[model samples]
Target: MRTLETIIIGAGPCGIRTAIILKEAGVDVVVIEGAAPGGKINIAPRVDNYPGYKMISGPDLAAEFFSWLNDAGVEMIGDLVTSLTKEDDLFIVQCEHNTYKAKSVLIASGTKEKKLALPKEDKFFTRGISYCALCDGHFHKGQDVLVIGGGNTALKEAIFMADIAAHIYLIHRRNEFRGSNKYVKELNDLPNTTILTPYIPVELIGGDRLTGVKIQNVETKEERVLDVQGVFPLVGQIPNSTYVKIPGVLDQWGTIPVENKTKKTQVPGLFAGGDILPRDIRQIYLAEVDGKMAAKAILAYLEK
Candidate 1:
């Protein structure tokens, strides 16, 4: 078991930002990441909202952040944390490869992509269904693909796929898109993309591989089948807090309730930030702010 002053349980913006602050303050800390460092941001095709950068690809921005982390000399461990437990005055973080003991712990695990609960959706996962267009779009070059959802993610995925895929079917349950005007307009301008509004996915059609999808009109009971080789469901995200079973800490939505200013959780010495923290605006800039706030609060708590 390794002992540390603090353990940050993610390598996303929040965790990386927190590590930078703590390291600059001369505090000992280590970051643990289950996958590659970027988290969900890696899948985003383009990010236009984050301040300081006008229009940058998600992977590029993530690379810049990782460069900063390296310059700050923050140590990162590549392992999945299985459980976190409070033991006396210390916190025990159990990972797949190692165990860590720390005076304080920060849970910034972020959110995981939500899946469309259509029949056989799980069976076709990564076989023909995907959540990341940037990651899987190349596989379907010049092929037909269907995108689900009406939010920014869905629109962005469609826009990204329009370049690689021969034709894209953008499906949404609502008549209007909930994404930004710029993205919606960009998607509409694409010649290879077709928008299907007021429709819901009924079933996936294929065996061992995805070949088509069954959809229905929300207003009317009319159903139709789309001949597409791939499907990308960009609906929404859920908090990655299944391993965090601390009673009275998580809300009904499985998000951590923390002070807006301090980012301190109800549990002593346990903090949360980023998407895992309950907040209406879930953005990378806000996640960075949460990281700074949590770092300051953790430093203050360590002094006492």
Candidate 2:
């Protein structure tokens, strides 16, 4: 087995970010990606909320991250981690190809996006439908858009789109919002964003690409037509920790639990960050921050 100081699972923003930091610190780090290196970030059409660029494509940003990893002298291995176990003082990471050993491990595999069961929703993903507003909002500048759900994430996406889109149609099945009052107020303040309550989406409209949505008022039994260029589904996030077993760590609504302040997990040598770990905010910048924090924690643990 190949030995290493740290092993990063998942090639998403968090894993990639952690690898860069460790490599720059002269720490031995190797990245193992289950799928392509881009992971979920590539599904986005465009991203504008990240610090540096006013607007940049999601794939382009991911590419830049990859470039940064290579420049930092980090090595990447394309393999899915099937199992993880502790052997003596080291951790055994098992993949289909081979087994690797590391002193510490960082879990950064973000969750997969939950989609509307509608047929066209999948076919038009990234083309007309999106899951991340910060990543896809710029592509819809000055265009009418529809936001699904009435939770915190939904309202957050609505507020983000209100700034870039000409108009927004906020649809929710219930007459209430599960999101905090502050966010609800912010989204409600947008003149261009119209909130539709007690409305259920029957199906996504359009054939080749998403053009609009079909919704029905669940309480009133009324239907309405809202024309839109894109539909953003911000229902919620499901974590990527189901397969791995580590005691003392809990998952809330399918998200891994961690110490909020330090992003440290219950396990001594294992840490988690980004969307997979429990966090209030799941933005790109915050995800990167979580990754940095986790890296620091790992460094500290290793030093001890």
Candidate 3:
């Protein structure tokens, strides 16, 4: 197996940032990513909060990050890490194609979206079902669409879809929204948007491509089906920590608990950062900060 001083289990903003820092510090490090390097950021339509860019598309920002990685001489590998284990004094990383040994490992693996898991949900995915409003909303322009959830993501996406889709039906399981009042008010003000409360998705209705969704009232047994060309589910997120074989490092929510300053986990040689951490704010710049912190901590760990 190949050997290295450190291995980063992702190639998203955090992992790439960490690798850049380590490589510039003359440390041996490589980043392994299962999918595209940008992680979930690739699906975002526009990012207005990140520093240095007043307004930029998610893909453009990701490209800039990739360029920075190349300038820093950091190496990235396109491979999925299946498992991570510790043996003797080295960490063993098992991937789909190869295995490697490292003195330390950083888990920057991000989170995945929570699904509705209703019947035929899998069959209609990408056909008429989607998780990102910005990614698939354009395809259904001038058409009717459905947005599910009461969180900020769902609200913001519903507002965005208002300009594109002819009509939008926003459904939430609770009568009140979990998002900020600003977002809720903005979504409510949209003339093309309709808010339905205290309802849960029951089933998907369509053949081949989805034509509608069936939802049930949470308190009552009342059910209704909305006719739309697309359905966007923006409920919540789940951490990608299944590959971590180490115990006691993961919390009840499957997120990693790290030191506030160092981003160090319970294990000495294993660290975690980015969206994998249990932070309320999941932003690009914050993830980059986690990477910088973890890199500094890993360097100290390697020196000892």
Better of 1 and 3 by TM-score: 1
Cand. 3 TM to true fold: 0.92
Q: What lDDT does the true structure give each of the candidates?
A: 0.90, 0.81, 0.90
Q: Count the backbone clashes (under 3 Å) in each candidate.
A: 0, 1, 0
TM-score of every prediction relative to native: 0.97, 0.71, 0.92
Q: How well does candidate 1 score on lDDT at residue 71?
A: 98
lDDT by residue (tens digit), candidate 3, 98-163: 999999999999998899878888999999999988778899999999999987778878888899
Q: Candidate 3 overall Cα lDDT vs. reference?
A: 0.90
Model 3 misplacement above 4 A: 219-221
Worst 10 residues of 3 by lDDT: 40-49
TM-score: which is higher, 1 or 2?
Answer: 1
Best by lDDT: 1
Candidate structures ordered by TM-score, highest first: 1, 3, 2
Query: The CA-based lDDT of model 1 is what?
Result: 0.90
Question: Cα miss at 24, model 1 (Å)?
Answer: 0.6
Q: Give one digit per residue, the lDDT tens place, for model 1 in 1-304.
A: 7899999999889999999999999989999999888678888899985778888999998888889999999999999999888888989898888889999999999998888888899999888898899998999999999999988888988998999999999999999877888888888898888899899899899978999999999999799999999999988789988878567888999999998899888889999999898776678988899999999999999889
Which stretch of 10 consecutive residues in model 2 shows the poorest summed lDDT? 243-252
Clashing pairs in 1: none
Candidate 3 backbone collisions, by pair: none
